[model samples]
Target: MLAEADNGAELAASMAELKAYLRIESDGEDAVLAGLLRSAAALCEQFVGQWLIRRGARETVPADGRWHRLAARPVVAIGAVAAVDDAGAVTPLPVEAYAIDIDASGDGWVRAVRPGNRLAVEYQAGMATDLNGVAEPLRQGIMRLAAEHFVARGDEGAAPPAVVSALWRPWRRMRLS
Candidate 1:
């Protein structure tokens, strides 16, 4: 399971930026809009298979030969690796025991030179560290999605808005067969 890292960074979009995009005149619904922005950012992350802001990511994969693929994209850096004992206590694995590759393509790969039964790897992954670093397309996509969610208020639809998908298309991970 790939979970968000507890790095204490804010989401890629702020309430003021979202408010400006949405054209809300008053702060009457700031709290509600804030929640919507978070939820919308999460939905965008799921849709694109990527994190928009810096966050720690921990992935556990059973050893298969000497190499294992990290699930999250645009990995910023690898933090630590550990071997889980049968009792589930984690011992940190030495840096020499593994190798990390963050290639130009943005897909990350890790290899365990000394394979263990189950290896837990911690890393940082995201497209940007903050809102200012986020690409314009992605920021626009988040605003569009949040606005739709705010207006519709949980209405399920046949498909996502074309603009959202289009803006996120380049960042979407392509599945390999």
Candidate 2:
């Protein structure tokens, strides 16, 4: 399961910023701009392979006496860890019952002291809790990408400009196969 925290005000502020960047002084295109911003943010997150906005996530993995990596990166906190039975019963585990680790690159892992059938790990992950807290390059990339989209609204086949990727490449997470 996954859920994002409330960031409406921050999102509104970002949309306002985008409008200002585009020199749009009227609300005439607010709806279209909002959609473009959301699309830009989604694309940016996809390129970076991490949630740019803070959110809650629950990942279930086998508790086979081995370390299991969590899907989300830059984990802000682990809220809980629990064991689940075949019957769907959940038993909360104490903090001491498991070990949590976050590497320098922000990858997270958890291992249970005693093996079980499966475990559920709940956590918060992201680079920022709100748009204003996001890294400046990322924030600028979102605006620039949105502006590009706005300009190319009717050009359905046009790909995003290379600048967006240039701005976000440094933060992209690589996965070893």
Clashes per candidate, residues 3 or more apart or on different chains: 1, 0
Query: What Cα-based lDDT does every candidate model obtain?
Result: 0.77, 0.84
Off by over 4 Å in 1: 6-9, 154-160
Task: Give one digit per residue, the lDDT tens place, for model 2 in 70-168.
Answer: 887788787789988888789999888888888877778888889888888888888887888899999999999999999987899988889889999
What TM-score against the true fold does each predicted structure earn? 0.86, 0.91
Candidate 2 residue spans exceeding 4 A from truth: 1-9
Winner by lDDT: 2
TM-score of 2: 0.91
Residue pairs with colliding backbones in model 2 are none
Give the Cα error of residue 129 in candidate 1, in Å.
1.0
